[model samples]
Target: MQPKKNSIIKTLKLSKKKILVFIFFVAALVASFLFVLKDIPESATIGANNYPQSTKIYDRNGKMLYTFYTTKNQTFVSLDKISENLKKATIAIEDRDFYKHGAIDLRGITRAFIYTVFKKQVQGGSTITQQLVKNSLLTPERTITRKIKEIILAFVVEGVYSKDKILEMYLNQVSYGGTAWGVEAASYVYFDKPVERLNLAESAFLAALPEAPSIYSPFGSRPELGKKRQLEVLRRMEEQKYITKDQRREAGEFQLKFSKIQNKISAPHFVFYVKALLVQKYGARAVEQGGLNVTTSLDLDLQNYAQASVAAEISTLERMNVTNGAALIAKPGTGEILAMVGSKDYFDEENDGNVNVVLAKRQPGSSIKPINYAVGLIKGFTAATPFVDEKTCFPNPGRAPYCPLNYDGKFHGVVQMRFALANSFNIPAVKMLKANGLEAMMATASAMGIKTFEDL
Candidate 1:
């Protein structure tokens, strides 16, 4: 009986030790978490001044070209001033349980973790508070440490600010698209009206842009994508019971007319190009709100002159169906862009006038003939080399033969390399390309600073 009692006592002692170790582990974890939380900023520190400053772009002669900013474009309207439809629409699409949930949604986080780990698909599980913290306080990094910081900051922000205040701050600071920031700015930029004037359909359309501003911008390259996103927003609104099915259908069917871009700036294309470079170097947030004063290599006078010339020339060529034109002038010695006219008229929305044709991909046409001839010259073919310019067809494996023809639809038989190149005969150029080898010609074109030919 004494031996059995001693065995039970020994078992009790082992259990006591295990309990102590578990308690110590939990305490250590709590202490480490507190330590991490101590470094995070309080929500009160984030204010109007914490918002990004406007970046000013200037020409080489100190002429102001454009002012880029979130704050500059933003109008600080109270929650009441903003449309109720926009608020509900944003909540429906962005976060349905925004008011009910805390700073973080446990279910959303769990779902995101499962999708990211087991399914190998990344998903955003951030609440509205988390998004505000990430945009305002945190850098745009995708590291675990950054995410942890974002979550912690979100909690801190929620603890200090009221839910309505947080929503107002978010609506006032979030980027809509292009140079527009916040709902008020977005309203003016997209609808050419005040925030209070936005209808339910317009509100839903605007709400769709915050997820991906550039991709869903109505004036952007894929304009049709914005409408698709708008429909999704309307559907979400209906599902959340924020709107009726009839309202959703009406909003989806509503035809929206986007405001035309009327930016008063010199050298629109060059300014945007330089802005892109700055964004690449300093990040989009910094370029838009860092108060950077960028002095570009563009000459304002030269840019104005070039723009006028291109517009005049395009107008005269309207009889021939040439409705748009672009011109880019650069200095010979330093490669400085003196002037860049992206289109005949930057405000012509019907003809896609805002597109920078100087940087757009296009067939070189006869302009590439010089490079072909140059390649031929390098590959033991001289200017006096004789080439038959008769009807010719290059063979293609498993495809129809590529037949070449001259611009005049008549062949000049037995022409020299110089005459064939000078006249821009298509048949001779094809023969030159075939003789020089496609690989050799492509390499030559790449070497001559034609980057688009490398992939071909």
Candidate 2:
């Protein structure tokens, strides 16, 4: 009886081994299918206007003044191009286990998952590659679907690319602060140094900037919060043995050589051109994610001139009880907006941002008359097309009588379409719209880029 019981136990143990082996094979096959080793896809493409690189603002002679970009707005470079300190600082802060992982670091993922699942708090355990992917390709909006995709892609990128290649791509594509992509851009914009010249303290500081860009970017409008974050980075660096105790002490006390935000575009209206391009090309997702690189037709020289002219007008308006003003410049034929100055300065001081004004609709006043004239033009009403320019009482066919007046508060007699529109005579527009029989004029305006109708 004892020998028979022992035999039954041995049979059961052998059966369990076979079942476990089968299960392992099934999981391996599924994982293999999910992350096929060949033909990796480019994560997300950062496109520019007409140009392959981001929309670069050039001078009349073709010098780059401002560049619109999604991430770093530059090429993904090789690791050999970067400094050892930057590599160390990034690996120390981002992913200490990058050399060993398949796109997904299961241990880190497990740790983060367990903590969040049990503690119910926001935490980030993503590798540097994951962060770079999120910065360049994915939105920050938290979702399970995005996480799964990120892990799969990370594993695939890791298998295909070398460690240095991944780090180089990460450094170049990551965001440092508001519209500042890549560590090199941040270096030029902030400390006025190149990425290669960044000291350990500065490199650590830049690494810290991504955790909460708007709040911790020392170069941005806010410095107090940035200082606090710098200290936190120092502490973490020490805890991770990235720096010695003495190194941490020295870095903690180190004064970051930061600078104020450069107000490049004096033109408020040109901000609208970029915003419109972002909305048109990348959609609302890219705009909100700050991953859009816009290459525009704007000439910095022309934009600066326009911004100065418009600002002067705003100053004059303030004296007349008008505190706000806006302006725009568009390329001919294509109608691509070259420059848009949104506000005198709308950058947020609190969270470090501002709303764009050029896209915002203000009362066009006489400016709207141009659209109506455009309508008349489309209806074969050339500049020579004659129309009555009388302010004579306007009444609906069977409705209340109304009257429209020109800015001069006087009526122009009969005039040609060219003279009426070029002179911006308001009464002619009202009469023209009335004569075009309302419905046809409405259709014409809709076809000619007039968005919504409020006062129409």
Over 1-456, each residue of candidate 1 has an lDDT whose tens digit, in order, gives 999999999999999999999899999989877776776666676655556656778889988787677546765678999999999998887777889999998887787799999999775688889888887777787877677878888888888888898898888878898767778778867887779899999999999998999999877899899899899899989898899999898888888988777645668888889988999898999887676778988999999999999999988999999999999999988989989999988779999989999989898898888888899888788999999999988998889999978989998899999999889999989988888888887788889888875354
Which candidate number would show the highest lDDT if scored against the true structure? Answer: 1
Error of 1 at 279 (Å): 25
Error of 1 at 342 (Å): 24
Clashes of each: 0, 16
State residue 140's C-alpha deviation in candidate 2, in Å.
Answer: 22
* TM-score of candidate 2 relative to the true fold: 0.49
Tell me each candidate's TM-score.
Answer: 0.51, 0.49
**lDDT, candidate 2, 333-369, per-residue tens:** 9886666666554453442224456666667677767
Please report, in order, the local distance difference test score of every candidate based on alpha carbons: 0.85, 0.66
TM-score of 1: 0.51
Which segments of model 2 are wrong by more than 4 Å? 1-76, 83-189, 192-257, 261-292, 348-357, 362-364, 377-382, 387-391, 397-400
